[model samples]
Target: MRREGSKAFYIHTFGCQMNQADSAIITSLLQREGYHPAENENDAGIILLNTCAVRENAVDRIEHYLQHLQGMKKRDKGLIVGVAGCVPQFQREEMFTMSPAIDFLAGPDTYRTLPLVIEQARAGIRLASLEFNAAETYEGIDPVREGLISAVVPVMRGCNNMCAFCVVPFTRGRERSHPFKSVIVEVQKLVASGYREITLIGQNVNSYSDPEDGHNFADLLDAVSSEAPMARIRFTTSHPKDISEALVRTIAERRNICNHIHLPVQSGSSRMLDLMNRGHTIEEYREKIALIRSVIPGVALSTDIIAGFCGEQEEDHQATLELLSAVRFDSAFMFFYSERPGTLAARTLEDDIPEAVKKRRLQEIIDLQNSISDKHYQDTVGTVVEVLAESESRRSSEQLMGRTDTNRVVVFEREHYQAGDRLNVLISSATSATLIGRPEHGVVQH
Candidate 1:
């Protein structure tokens, strides 16, 4: 179980919340086998890259990082280099050929077998574990918490929907919910450990269902809130078509559930939507948003928007802009589309959108969202909302930063406040992306 005389490993994660949750599981597994977490790559015996392949830019960054790790390996021969998560799942043995410095490669489903792989790597064996496992949830594995403020707990894995631009279905495989009891147990543990927030993560969290236990996402949310009434509960990346009224109702009923939802609507035109195989039309997505707002009044909404796709036209871009004006999301994650390798789009469609056009469209989306976000922030000025203190403000040490239940960042003057305290903040100033506040007289309880 020992990696030479050293037992430290550092995992650098890329991609989404699912990958972050996977990194936590890997940390716990390695610790159980006597591996300590290294502070940095140079301090570690093993340097693990938990990669992403959703966009080509992320893959490019990984390739650059690999070169740095390889240079470090040349100076220190004892360092064990490895790659995990989505990138390795797709690239597999090709990654080994590309980066000979890597000693081990483990896929998202193959993390549990990593200890054996580490042993093989110790014996100078280059190893790769890229096979998919239908029933592996890392069920009994308890993730080691790195911080006490907030934690990402994965309730499920994989994706069943094959969005033409998506690489998740191929990398993470079909959807599978973890055992319901195990999920509740982890929530209880996090609450007991003084964590203030928990975001249930998955490729598409709305699809969580366990037929044997007769439990769905709504049931799980109820159980978690019932188990840890003081912890702020949240979940992310809900599929537009699958988001239910029951889920929205559950949030309304619970005082601790965050009043925010991130439902990604990649395109606004029906033609473009069908081309991407998103499984939901613009009208249907509009209905889901309407339902969510009806159930939970004043709930902050956010979305993901792609500027260019395989055959995106000027009319399609105009349609997307119109949708932005209509929805007026509090915030958005926007990207100029990049077709991923091994995806349906890559195999069947041509990436014919000119780069200049994609960039222009993306900038337009950004400008529009910025205006909407500014209006939302200005509206919040003079309102008093609860904020869980997360850390010192990056802009100023004299201030502390936290988030409102709506998941908006609010920075306020630090006055006898700590990292975990919940404060009633009086919103005083507004920016496009942040709200500046001051602590009010009364405390806000979770």
Candidate 2:
């Protein structure tokens, strides 16, 4: 039976860049089946929450969001409420029990079955498709991207790392790289379509290996840069152990590759790292960081830090703080640990840290990072940096907002430029999070 409402769909994505890329693929698949994009939930017949399972609060947020959707379903009888991505894969039938409005559940690998699931849903059938596929790369599937200035191409899927605190291995399954030729083709297509920046995304992008040519992540990066010389290339979420010398060298040599690397060192203590099953110790991670900095001068380094983990001692916390002071990351994503279920940490270790202590440590981490970020941004005063103007600033349309090659946000007064125009800007003032600048004297629009 056909769905009994307008063929319009809305996806509220809540997660990392991988989820955003998945939403794009979902949009492409549904559009092929004649479904139009809806501006919001009220105007759509289908609403899918692409959820995350990394932290407990993320799942809680999605559950709370789903409970509020009951009113929308009451108003539109034919509305098909669904859940996709890591949350569905992890929660399974519990998602339906927790949120009764959900019509179907689809895992990361089962997105291709969405159209069929919707058809079954219209016939009063509720179901969950949570099977894992080792070889589902979704090759040749062109994403329906909305960005002209920047776009993300998922070069690979899943993770093999399986850190003790993470649920990705269970939710996203094993690592699988997209075919090399298909990835290059996607990059070429995006460049041809006028995309200025292309980010090759994955759970752990450094582990990407071409199935056909036995090529590695560095090889794939070299190929992408060679194929799309006009477009700037970037990648994310590199594992500390997987980062190779070749990868750092490739970034240094490639003129178009952005000079930013987001390498997540979850904790700073070697003992804490061992408890977390992080594979690499503090010394090894620091060595890798030193290597990256030496190879690529003036590279912007960012990281992820968890303040409190299972059995985290005060000494461990101090170690993280000391690491922050020593490394002085340009920025960081810091949070108190939220134990995820079914992970090695949850099953084996006790969530022993007191809530008060956790929050205090988190705040300390935040304050230290703020000061470090302030000093870094303040140093940028009177320097010239290249920025790709993305959109009008939120404060005023008279000002334009963009990002530097180091991934720093910059806002400057609007001149004759538009979105996607790359121009050099001379930094005049700055906040901890943003750089206020004006066009440079020799501004050349690319």
Candidate 3:
């Protein structure tokens, strides 16, 4: 039977993978309340923007999108428009003033109240809530995982670190880990449902420790991987300071754990690291990188880099560039330092670097990383790697696309192969962004 709904909703999401996971839970919440998803905003009875406030421009972008929604509301006076996630998680009152079109608001921790908020909004009551639940990790909520082949399971919520430039501590509240058994149960269900991949997500995944049993991050990872040995296990957003050798060894030893880690080195200069309170030094990060390489010889390394941070000098930018060249990271997510309201950087330091300087530094970082990535991709040619077939290649129907354990996109000939099939493919050629390959042995397992 239908979970809910002749009524429909449209969840427009922004920000990180964590936000994507949150949006999924919100979908489940609305579905359980008897609402279905609309094909688009025009068809939906409600429009909710799962927002981000990591950068000032992200908020600007959401506000700009809200302007268009005003016309949608004009067509249906009863249409509910709401804002959720980190953008309003800490600034709910400001959000109410930012856009008159919004009829309601919610925070990262207050999604359980969404149905009631909607009901009240429809009755001519505009309300907003940002109640932080000490234990809310949306555990009881069964999320719509979007598909069966891969699922995102949030094992923890919030962060304890108050990085000088970050708003996460303020927006997401204090660090709290989810119950270990609940996480294990969730992963077991996904595997039973034919999920071949599970990505354990969190604000700081390495910091996760079970609330009841006192199991640490590595313990949880071991449990999940043991439960589903054939499934590709992956995790995200590891802070450098918390990355343990045990975690690195687990990735090396576990047959299922994908050998890719997202270690964010916001800046390579120790001076900047101290200012950001990232809790690690450049030399220490380099040592960790060395340890990771020693353990997982072929690990694909990715990272996040911020350019022109507060009080950044030309030398600091040079230092970042030098690290990019030295590490030769396979890929990176690069951004210009944008002061978020309520963050330490905004309250105390200057966004002292000129906008032009930030842009220049960011572009230089991108160009360097791309060249390095090209070099790395070229070196992988002729290697036989196993990739889990995912979808029809966007370029052609005759080609199938999937990702290597290192997380590189590999496109291969589609010869009776189907999605979820793992195939051994030999790299034939490379583009700047993708690797083209041919299947070594067709249809190994689907």
- Quick one: best lDDT, which candidate? 2
When 1 and 3 are scored with lDDT, the better candidate is 1
lDDT score at residue 325, model 2, on the 0-100 scale: 95
Clashing pairs in 3: 4-34, 5-34
lDDT of model 3 at position 146: 76
State each model's C-alpha RMSD to the native. Answer: 1.7, 1.6, 2.4
- TM-score against native, each model: 0.97, 0.98, 0.96
Report model 2's TM-score to 2 decimal places: 0.98
Q: Quantify all predictions' global Cα lDDT against the true fold.
A: 0.90, 0.91, 0.88
- Candidate 3, residue 211: lDDT: 95
- lDDT tens per residue, model 3, 1-446: 11122278899999988999998999999899898888787777788999988877888899899888886666667778899999888687778888788989999999999999998888888988888887898888889867668788999889999899999998999899999999999988888899988999998999999999999888889889999887999998788988998888888889899999999998989999998889889999999999999989889899999999999888888999999899889999899998888898889888889999999999998999899999999998988889998889998999999999899999999988888988899999997678999999666565
Give candidate 2 misplaced runs (Cα > 4 Å).
1-3
Residue pairs in candidate 1 whose N, alpha carbon or C atoms collide under 3 angstroms: none
> After TM-score superposition, what is the CA distance of residue 421 in candidate 3 from its true location, in Å?
1.2
Give one clash count per candidate, in the order shown.
0, 0, 2
